[model samples]
Target: MDPLGDRVNRNGTPTVSDPSPGSEGGLALSGTRTLLLTTFTHVLVDGYGIGLSVLLALLFGRNGRFALVGLILSAYTLATAFAEPLWGRFSDATGRRGAVVGWGLVFASASFCAFGFVSPEGPWAGPLLILFALAAGAGAGTYHSVATALVNEVTSRENRGLVQGINNAGGSVGRTLFPLALAELAVVLGSPGWAVLPFAGAGVLLGLATVSAFPLASPRTFRAGTASPSPDGPMDRRFLARMVALSFLRTAFFVTAAGFLPTYLVAVRGLDERAMGTVMTLVMSTGILAQPLGGSLSDRLDRGRLLAGLLAGSGAAFAGSLLMEGLWSSVALLGISMFMVLMTFPLLFALMGDVVPGNRLGAATGLVTGAGGLAATLTQATVGVLAQRTSPVLVLLGLSALGVLSGWMAMGLRAPRSPGGRRALGS
Candidate 1:
């Protein structure tokens, strides 16, 4: 076999070596296990972290202070920004993303425990909450970056999109389940803090499960160029120009939905908790489902055009929310909007993976993820403030308009061409 040749291992029929990577072996049951485990880890971490916002709002607003909610939410994003790239960089440099993530799980578990132990009523709450946010953020951010990189390293582009989508969907599912569970838990126990225990316990189990899922991170090769970045390069020139804007627009549209959708359902439409949860679930559920389909579609279609359509669809979905008259109508709009966003995500990341080499992939993804998270944070704050000062309907509408604009622009994305195609790789 050629040193770089991809082949099926005798032990695992139907398995494909990632043709792009230098991995010696073929996929096996072990490979499938890795994928499932990593995806599950993503969902759990995301659920524990993102779902906290919903719980926080409930805890704080139940007492008549919804003002500080965005601050608390932003703290998590801030932690993600600071930690994600550092973790990714370290993983690449040391070739130990698994260890990094495993250690991160330890932190994630500790974060939840801290959240459980720290009381808003405690005089010591402020510092403890900060600690919790940092710990939680650190864990959540690493999961996506590491998982994405790991997936790309292990899978061929042929199915890479599907894998990324499944992993993302898992995270969305976690986000959906955990919050609703916490909401129910909060009600049943008659104390918001009581809602904390289940999530905290789950985090511990999840951390251990995640650590066990990954083998020790080892050097893997892929069909990437230099696995690093060069400012002087042509493809990177386009990527550099595109990354921030793409990340910003993606998050802006997403948070616009997240920030306002619940409020719209509950406030304007008068959906109860169960109903509200159902609506949120539907939107995210669609997004989760959309991931693999979208990725695979991108594999077959022009990715740039697909991204444009996804963004535009998201915008239109938000626009449709204004016209939604009942639960079913709201559900439809929510489903379509989220599907657009979720499907677009893995495709965009795949593009990044294609252009970025193994070494730079982690760093670039970390930065873009940070940019997206930052955008999500800002959009959330803006939407919340707007919801407070005016109407969620208006905010949703404005965001929808932006989505339309982004889609129009996305139509122009050409398949990323290196100034020199294969020759430019690894230069």
Candidate 2:
């Protein structure tokens, strides 16, 4: 029997095997524990990733150099894009998924903590910032593919969508809370640098905890039975291309809108740091509800059409937000846009799970997320440069237009057919 309880029949179809008598209950408990732990750690990893942007905005202040800050931010994203596939491949090969997750958290947290000690005005600041940011990004990049694959390995197909949604919701919670916590800390501590230390310290503590606990919960053992290739054969090249394109455009839209939101609120909207943080928290909080709901809906509806509608709705809402005169009204519209856009994340991931074989999931996920990270890097660089000459709001309007185009592209996507001659929930 395969270590993960999966096997291929003579007809080449993959099916899960039943656990040994009396072992089923233990397996279920183990899987649940793994899911919960992975989800919580996801909170730390994603929190550091998103919260870094807010920290940068706080450090630079409203009147600081936009282009330089953009380059610095781009370095972090570019490093992450470059490292994701490498980490994914490694995890897939070694089956050391827990090691990647645990160590990555530690390394990234330590790097960020080191960053807190560097004075912004010092001569060595630029080089040091880039170095630490790159380290942090690379470390943070290890979680998504490896951890998601770990979760998928243990979960049953019937509940996969809901499981992914729950995991993703944890990330959204992190994104929502971490920035607010940092902003509140800045207010109380009177310095962004000092504020970051405590947050990073928390990550270190969590990393240590994960490292200690994960080994007992998720064994590091790998056997030949678990090394079989996917029974579905190699993934279709055309499908890979389409998924990559969708991932790229979706990420470009998200990063352009949300990545720079703090700067946009502070520099463009003239909001104070606390108010900017609050608005950002509000915008990101929508994902907590949106992802799980979308996950449930995806299981019941046509995922392609649902994703298309959500993307289109996000574009329209974003455009409406730009036209609103009142700050709160604009915030309300932006929140709606965020809600719709965030829903698509789990849908896309679940779609990938539906089509890709379990053995190759890590590599495939790495590729898609790497593309998204690249898009974020490019979009951030462009937005930063453009903001120097024009209003950030104008650049955001352009992104909103692209979001609509992404929606049109999504309309053509279809889920793969199952052996029963019915379309699957995700393709």
Give the whole-model CA lDDT for all candidates, comma-separated.
0.65, 0.76
Tens digit of per-residue lDDT, candidate 2, span 1-427? 3223345444433355544445432235445666777788878777777787787778675774566667777888888888887888887776667667888888998887777667778899878988988999998888877777777666544455667778888888988997788898888988767877876787787777667655422332222222222225677667667888887888788866777778777887888888988998998999899988887788778788898999989988998898888999999999999999988877787777777776687888889888988998898888888877787678778879868877887887877787789875444
Least well predicted 10-residue stretch by lDDT in candidate 2:
221-230
Cα miss at 120, model 1 (Å)?
Answer: 5.7
Residue 289, model 1, lDDT: 70
Candidate 1, 41-142: lDDT as tens digits = 777776766466655545454342333455556677777867777777777676566556666766776676567555677777656676677778877778
Question: Which residue pairs clash within candidate 2?
Answer: none
For model 1, what is the alpha-carbon lDDT of residue 140? 73
| RMSD to truth, every model | 6.1, 4.8
Which regions in candidate 2 have their CA more than 4 angstroms from the true location?
1-27, 214-231, 425-427
Off by over 4 Å in 1: 1-30, 61-66, 116-131, 212-215, 221-235, 417-427
